[model samples]
Target: MSETRVHRADVKTAHQDLHSERGALRGEHPGRSRNPLIKVVDLAWLEFEKPDLDRAEVFARDFGFQIAARTDRELWLRGTFAGSPCMVIRRGRTSRFIGPAFHAPERADLDRLARATGTCVRDTDVPGGGAAVDLLDPSGFPVRVVDCDRALSALPEQRPLLLNSGTDHRRTNATQRPPREPSRIQRLGHVVLETRLFARALDWYLDTLGMIVSDFLFLDGRRDRGPTMAFIRCDRGSVPADHHTLAMHLGPGTGYVHSAYQVTDLDSIAAGGEYLAERGYRRSWGIGRHIQGSQLFDYWRDPDRLMLEHFADGDLFSCDVEPGWAPMSTSGLAQWGPPATRDFLGAGPSPQRIRDVIEALRGDNEMDLTRLLGLLKAANS
Candidate 1:
C-alpha cells in the first residue's frame, strides 16, 4: 500500500498560515497540557473595586446589565443568561480590577483543585452561596475556581432582528427599526489581559484549569521565542465553546485590558453605541469585525476608565480543533474596520505606562528591552 501524505500548501488558506499540528512539527509549543488539575466549565464572574457604588450602578444600567443584587457597599450586575452574575463591583478607595472567578463543573473538582494547589476551599458570601479556592497566577493575578449551588434564572432575551440579504429576504415588508437603547448583554464572553510574565501565566492557566489554546500570535521576527499572545478556550471535550474565554498578551503592564459581553447582533451594537454616546460615554474603538474571534465588536470605557466591550457572533470551536498560528500586527487585528486606535492599543503616552515599561525592564520577568521593542513594532506594524 502507498503511504498517505498531506501537503501544507494543499490545506493552507490565505487567511490561516499555521495550525497546532504544523507548529508541533516545527518544534513549537503544543499549547495545552497532558494533565491538569481540573477543567473549568466557564467564567463565573469578574470582581472589581470602584470608588463610588452609585456611579457604578448608573453605568451598569446604562451599559445594559440588569442589577442582580445591590447594597450600599457592593453592586452585582448580571446579563440575560441563566448563570452567575457577570460582575461584582465593591466600594473601594481606588478603582481597579480585582480578578476573575471561573466555574468548576462539580464540587469534587474544586476539592481536587484545592488539594493540587495546596489551598483550601472557602465559602463565598456572594448572592448565590458557593465555595471557592483562590490562587494567584504567575503574574500575580488572583484566580478563583468556584462551585455554586444556586444559578440565576435567565431573563427575557433580546431577540435578534431579521434582515434581508442577497437573494434572501428574512424580513418581509417590515421596516428595520432597532430602538436606540442599551445593548442587552447576554453573557460575559471573554476577557483580555496583558502580562509581563506571559509564558508563566499562559502555562498556569493551561495546566491549572485545563484550558486549550484556540489561536497563537507571535511577533514577526520572534517566532523562535514562542508565541507572545494566545486566545485560550475551555476544554469542553466534544462540546463547542467560545473561541476564547480568556486571552493574554505579552506587555509591560500586568492587568486587565478589556472584558467583552455578548449582545444580540450588529443592530444591537449600533443602537447601543448611540445610547452610550448620547449619554456622553467615551468610546475607545470598535464597531468592526475582528479577525481572530470573528466578533462584531464595540469598545467603550466606563466612568472609571475601565475598558468594556459589546460583542456578538463570536466563533465557537470544539476541543478537536487545533490552535491556529499567525504573526501579530496591528493590521491583523481586524478583517474589516478602521485602523486600530491608539486608545485600543494602549499606545497613547502616559506616565504610568512609561513607569511600567521601566519597572518591567528592571524586574526579573519575561519582558525585556528586545521583547518590548518587538511588541512596539508589532503594535505599529
Candidate 2:
C-alpha cells in the first residue's frame, strides 16, 4: 500500500482584514490555519520563447489579457486575475519554466517572507484591490504579489434562458444561442510544468503558494508508463475554485512550461481548442475531462514546445479538504479519451541502451551531445 502522507505545514503570514463577498469563509471554518496568508489571487508567470511575441501580444489582446508592457525581451500582460501583471513572455528560442505569481496578504507579509526565506523579494502594481510584492518561491519560480480580491467574471452579456409553453426550437433560430463572445476569458487557473527537481519542486510550491495537493502522480518506473501529474487548489474567496492553480513534474529539460486560461464552460474550451487548431498550431493533448481538477480541457503546443491549455467549468469545492493521490501509470492518468499520444508530452516510451552509446560517443568532441542525444532519442528504437 502507498503510504498516505499527511501535510500539516506550518505557516507565517501578516495579519489582514479578511474581507469577502459572502463573508470570509476561512473566518468561519474550524481548523483553518490562522497564519501563512497564502491566497494566490493572481498569476505572473513567464513565457520562455518570444517567437512571434508580437503575435502573442495580439492574441493576448484578443483573449482579454491587458498588455502591461512589451519590449524586445518580455511581454507583460495583465488581466482580472489580480492586481499585478498576470503573464509575461520572456524572449527565448522556446518557453522555459520561470515560476508562478502568488500574492501576499499584506506588505508586512512580503517583509516577513524576505526575512524568513532570504529570497530577493520585490514589489509591483497591476491588477488588484491593493499593493503587491514579488515572492521567490523555494523552487525558484518568481511569484508576483498583489492584495486584490479575485473579482467575479464579468461575462460580456448574460440573460436567463427560459423555455415557456411549447417553445419551438426550429423557430428560435435567430435567437437560439447566447450572444456572441469574442474569445472571452473567464479566469486564470493553474499551470502545469516539466521540471527536474520533483520532490523539491513539490515542497517549494506547497510551502510558498499555499496550494493544497488535490492529488499527486506516482510512477512505477516501468513499462511505457504515463507521467504522473499533480493537482492543486486556490480559494479566491468569492469563487470556490483553487482547482490547481499550478502543477509540476520532472522535466525533459527545465523552464516555464505552459499556462492555462479558463472559460465559462466545456463548449468554450472546445471552441478555443478548435480555433487554435484551425490556425495550424500543434496540439499536445486533451479536449477531455481531467479526473483531478475535474475541469473540461484541451491542450496545445506553443512555439517554444510548451503545452498550453484551455480549460473550463472545473469542479468547485468549499469543503476545504484536500484529498487523493495516485501512482503514475500509462492507463491511470486519463479516465477517458484517446490514449495520450505524444512522444515527448506525457511520458517517454521506454528505457535505452545507455552503456553502449556512452562508449561509442566517448570523446566525440565534434558532435553537439545535447542535440545528438535528443535526435537519437526521438528516433525509432
Candidate 3:
C-alpha cells in the first residue's frame, strides 16, 4: 500500500480564538516541532504494569495486538497503527499518566520541539533499530512524538482466533489459512481520559495544542450547568472526519487514562473481541455504544494489564465547532451496557499478573526482550 501521510491544511489559530492575541506561527505547525500535523491519529499507546506477564501476553494477543516482542519484564504489542506499539506491558505498578502519541513529520520536528519547549530532549531508539523522541507534557506523562518508520508483519490468521466455528458455519474456513493485508492503519481515531483536575488538564491541552472543543458534559455541581468533560478536535479545514481526536472527563485520577485505537469497522471490533476471548483474555468492558462520544467501543486487558480499546463509528467535530455542554449522567454515557461498574473503569491487574510484576520489580533474574526479537528476526529471514 502507498504510504499514509498527514497533509497540511490551513487551520485557524486556536490561540487567537481562545486567547486575545494571534501568538506563535501563522505558518504550518513547525514541521520541525516533532509533532505531526496530527490531522487525526490514534493514541498510539498506553503502557501498563501487569502483575501476570503470561496472562497479560495471552490477553493482548487474543484482543488482536500482534505480539511484537517479550522479555522477562516487558511485553510489546502492535496493531494496525503502522509499526507503532499500541500497548506496552511494563512490569511496574508505578507508571501513571496516559501519554498520547502524536506522529510528527521528521526528526527535525523533535529538534524544533527541544528549542520550542527549552527542554533537553532525546530519542529512544527502537530496541532493534529506528528511533523516536518522547515529548514531555504538563500532565507528567511524556507525550511521545515520532516521525517513525516501523514495519508490521501480517496477522497469522484471518479467522477469529477465539470464537468457535459453531457460531458461524462460514467461519469454518478460518481454521484453514489467512489472507494478505496491504497495510494502512486504515485510520486511528481518538482517546478520552478521566482527570481529577479536569479543567486544568483541559485548558493545558487546548492552549498547548491547537484543539477546539466540539462538545462537553457538565454534571450537577449545583446550578453550575457548565461542562465537566470536553471533546476537542485538531481541525483539518476540509478533512473528512467525524472523530474527536481527544476528550477529557472529570474523574478521580490524574494519570494517563485509557486511549483508543480505531479499526476498519464494527466487524473488526466484534471479531477481534471474540478472537481475544478465544485466545484466552478477560474482556474488560465494551461491545457497547458509549453515550458521550457515541462511539461503539470494545475494551480488553492486555498481558501487561493495561486497558486496550478498539473503536469505530465515533462522533466527530470540525475544528471551528464550539463547545457544547450538558449535565453529566451515567445513563447518558452509553447507549447500551449492563450498567457501568467500579471495576469497569479500574480493572485490576489480574491475580497472575500482579505476582509477576512483584517479582520483576524485586530484581528477579529476567529474560530479555532482545533474545525474543532476535528469534523473530531469524525466523522471518
Candidate 4:
C-alpha cells in the first residue's frame, strides 16, 4: 500500500490544529499494511523485571491491581475486568520493562503466526495458562502473541457515581463523597514507547500484528519528514476498540514511556491520586483530559520509577474511521489541566539522557541533527 497523499491545505490547517481530523496530511510512511499476518484482538499484558518483588507488589496493589498469583520468582497482577492478567513482574537483578503481550482471537492464529515467523508456539506459565508465539519488533522489543485458554471471571463491579452537573442534578438528597482509596483499575488500556527507529517500528507493528493508526503527530515545519508519533489501535472491523492500544514516538531513547490502566471515572482518578500522594508515591503528571485519546488521565511513579497512568472515559472507534494527523507540541498534549510537567516530559537534563542523545545522533538510526532540533522545538512549543 502506498502512503496516503495529504493536501498542502490540510498540512497548513493541521499545523494550527490540535484536534485530529480524518484525511489529514501524513508522512511518507503508510498508516497501515495492506495485508498483515494476523490481526491481534487486544493487548493482553505487559512484562517487567524488578529486583524487589515485595515492593513491586505493594505498589501494584496501591495502583489498583489485584494479585492474580504470586510466587517467590514471579508476581502476576490483574484488574477487575474478566480477562488475562494486566501485568507480570519477575524477580530480576534490576527493574526494567521486558515487553508486551497481545491477545490472539483464536488458537490457530498462534500456530499460523508461529509458522510464518519460523518460531515455535510454547506454553506460558501465566495465571491463565496459555500458549504464546514470541517475536521481536524492528526496535528489538520482545512481543508475544498468546491464545489464552482460560479467562479470569470479572471481579465485583465498582459502579460509577451519579453526578450533579450545571443543568442536570441526578443526586438530590444523596451527598457526593467519593472515598479516598485506591482506584479500582478496570483493565490495561495502552502503552507508550520511544524508539529511535520510529518509521521501521511503526511499520513492523502494522504489518506484523494487523494494527492500524488512529492518529499521527508530526513536528511543525517538518511535515515532509512524516509523522514522529502515532497512536495505534487494533482493527476490530465493526466493533469499537480503544483509541490507542499502543503509542510510539521517535526519541533518543528506545524503551517504555508509560502504561495506562482504565479506572471507573474522574472521581476514581482524583481520589486515587490523593490516596497515592498520601502514601508517599510521586504524582508524575495528569488529572487532565488528553487531546489524542480524550482520556482523563492521572500519572504516578512506581517504586521503581516506572510511570503508570490511571485513565478513564477514553474515545473508542470502529475500523472504518481513518487516521487523523496533527502537529506535535507540549501545549497540544491535553484539552484541559495543568501544564505538562518536565518530569513527565523527560525534559529535565540528566547524564544518562544526555548520553543517549549524543549516542543517538552519532548512530545510524533515524535520529539526526534536524530531527533532534525538531523534537526540542516541539517539546518547547
Candidate 5:
C-alpha cells in the first residue's frame, strides 16, 4: 500500500522577489549612538496590579515561575535563573500593568542615569537588594533602572532534549515522551508595548537607554509614513544580544502588549502549552516562528488577562548588524504557523475595543484617522 501524501502551495515563490528586495535594505540603520548615558543591559522584571493574589499565584506557578517572596499585599516570582525576582504582582482594587524594570550595564550607570534624567537614585526594598532610579517614559509607563546587589543561589537548569530526525537518528532504541510537568522558564527575554507616539517613544528609548533598532516595520504602501513598529535591542558592542529586548508599536492606546520568557526548546513550549491547557489557562496565540526575531513562540493570558509568551531558539545579533526594514502586514508577521487570530492581533471586534478606537479618533493622538485606517488595513491584510 502506498502512503498518503499531502501537498501545499508554495508561498516562497510568491514572495521571493519581495524578500530579495527587502534583504538588500538590511543593515541600512545600524542605530549605534556616539554618546549616551548608558546602555541598557536587559529587561529585569515587570510589575502588575492584580485584584486576587492567590488566583494570580496559581497562574504564575503553572506558567513555570517559582515564588521568590510573597506577602499579603505583594508577590514576587522568579524563574530558574539566578535573577531573584522576574515579576511582581501587587494587590489592587483594579488590575493593570504597572511597568517594567531594566538592568543597566553597571552600577555606576545607575548614578549616571539618575543625574541625567534628574531623578533621584534610591535603594530598592524588593527581593533583590538594589538601588533604583525610577522614572516615567514619554508614553506614561513607569520605568525602573536598578543596580542589583543581592546574591542569588542559582537554580537547576533544564537542557533541551535531543531529537532523532528522519535521515540521521540521534537516539538509538529510545522512545521519547516529554513530561507534562511545567516547562522551566530560563529568564525574561523581552516586553512589547503599544504607544500613541511612535517617533517620540522610539527616540526616547534610543536616546535614554542606548538601545538600537533591530528592525522596523512601516505601513504597507506608506514608506514615507515611517516605521510604526520597531524591534529594539541593547547596544552591547561586540557581544551578542537577543534580537530584541524591547519592542514597540504605534497604536490607539498606550499599554503593555505582552512579555516573553525564554524556555528550553520547541518541546518545552509544546509540552508547556499542554500543561497550561490541563490547568485551564487560555492561549492567546502561537506555536510558530516569528519573522523579525525568529523565535518559536507560544502566548498565553494569565489569570488577570495579562498576555505572556514562552519562546526559544531566538536570533542573536551583534552590534554591527543593521536594522532590517519591512512592511507591516498581517500575513507577514509569521514565517509559518496557524494564521493569526483576532485576539492575537489585539483586534477582536469587541465593543470595548471599538469604543477605544472611537475615543482615539475623537482625541488628538498618534492614532489619527489616517493612522487608524492604516493599522486596520495592515491587520486585515
Candidate 6:
C-alpha cells in the first residue's frame, strides 16, 4: 500500500474541491502531429522594453539577478544558471514584454525552423553568440529560439540548508535564519500571457513548439466553450519537465500576465519576500502553494508594474502524464494563501485595462461581456 500525503486543514477543502471537479477531459489534442519542425529544450530568457534602464537594473539586482552585461541602450541580467543572460531589458519609450527566447534542442533545429517558418536563420545578437530564428506567435508575441554552444560561467549559489521536521531531524541544535538577501534565482521557470483568442493561440504553441498541455481550466458550466487557461510544458520525452514552462489565459487584454523564476526552497521565497518588502517593493500576492504546479510562490511588481514571481518546490511531469481539467475559479488558483488579490486577478483598475475592456466589448472575441462578468463575479466571491 502507498501512503497518501495530506494538506493542511485550512487548504484541504480547496484542494479536495479541485480534485473532485477535475473532469475526465484531458486537454491533449488526440490528432496533434507527433513531429514538430523543431523541439525547444528550455526557456532561455525574456526580452522587455522599458523606458528607464537604470531603474530596471536596480530592480533586477534587488530581484537576485547579477548584471551580465550592459550598454547605454540595453541591459543583460543573468541568474545562477549557466545561461549567459537570462533576461534582457532594452530602452524604449513605453514599457512592455517583448517576448522570450527558447533553447533549440539542437543546432540543426534552427535551420529547420527558419525554413519551415519562411524566415532566415541569423546570428543571434543577444549576449550569447549563437544561431537563432525569430518568429511571431499567433498572438503576435515575439518568439526566438537560439542554438548556442557557449554559456557564461555559472554564478555561486547558496545550497538549501538541511531541514528539521516533526518526524525527521536533519539538523541538530542549529538555528535557521535564512539570509535577508535577494533570493538567488536558479533560472526562468515559466511565462504566462493573456490572449483574446485562447484556442487559436493554444494550438499555435502546441503545433509550433511541440509543447503539451499539462492541465486545462474551463469556465464552470461552459466546458463546451473550451478551456479559458492552459498550463503547457515542453515535450521532453521520458525526461521530466516543469509542470508548465508557459501558460496562456483568455482575457480581454493580450499582454503579459507574469513570469516565474525558480528559487531554492520555501525559505528562500519567504526571506526574499522580506528583503523585497523592506526595499519598498510592491508584493502582489504570495507565500502560497498553487493547485496546478504545486509551487510555493511569491509575486511582486517590477518598476514597470510587470508582475514577476519567485517560486520553489514546483511539480515536474513526464511526457506520459495526461492533462488534468478543472473549473476556473479564484479558490482553485491557490491551495492556501491570502485571498487572490485584484492585481493578481487582472481586475485591478487601470487605464490600459479599461481600454481593453472597451475594445473587448466592441469586438467579437472570447472576452465578451458575459464571460467578463463571470470572471468579475468569481473574483468577488
- Name the regions of candidate 5 deviating beyond 4 angstroms: 1-32
lDDT for position 207 in model 5? 83
- lDDT at 190, model 2: 67
**Better model by TM-score, 1 or 2?**
1
Across residues 206-319, which tens digit of lDDT does each residue of candidate 3 receive?
A: 544445565555444321323556767664554534546777755333444456776666667776666667656666777888754577888766544455578776765444
Of 1 and 6, the candidate ranking higher by TM-score: 1
Query: Candidate 6, overall lDDT?
Result: 0.83
- lDDT tens readout by residue for model 2, 286-317: 76776666667677765545666677666564
Winning candidate number (lDDT): 4
The models' CA-based lDDT, in order, is: 0.89, 0.52, 0.53, 0.90, 0.83, 0.83
Better-scoring candidate (TM-score), 1 or 3: 1
Better of 4 and 6 by TM-score: 4
Please, what are the lDDT tens digits per residue for candidate 6 over residues 65-123?
Answer: 88888999999888897875788999999999999899888888888888899998889
Over the stretch 58-131, how does candidate 1's per-residue lDDT look in tens digits?
99888899999998889999999998998999999999998999999899998899889899999986687999
Worst 10 residues of 1 by lDDT: 1-10
Ranking of all candidate structures by their TM-score, best first: 1, 4, 6, 5, 2, 3
* TM-score of every model versus the real structure: 0.95, 0.66, 0.63, 0.94, 0.91, 0.91
Better of 1 and 5 by TM-score: 1
Q: Give the TM-score of candidate 4.
A: 0.94
Q: TM-score winner among the candidates?
A: 1
User: Candidate 3 — worst ten consecutive residues by lDDT sum?
Assistant: 2-11
Q: Which scores better on TM-score, 3 or 4? A: 4
| Residue 285, model 1, lDDT | 92
lDDT of 6 at 125: 67
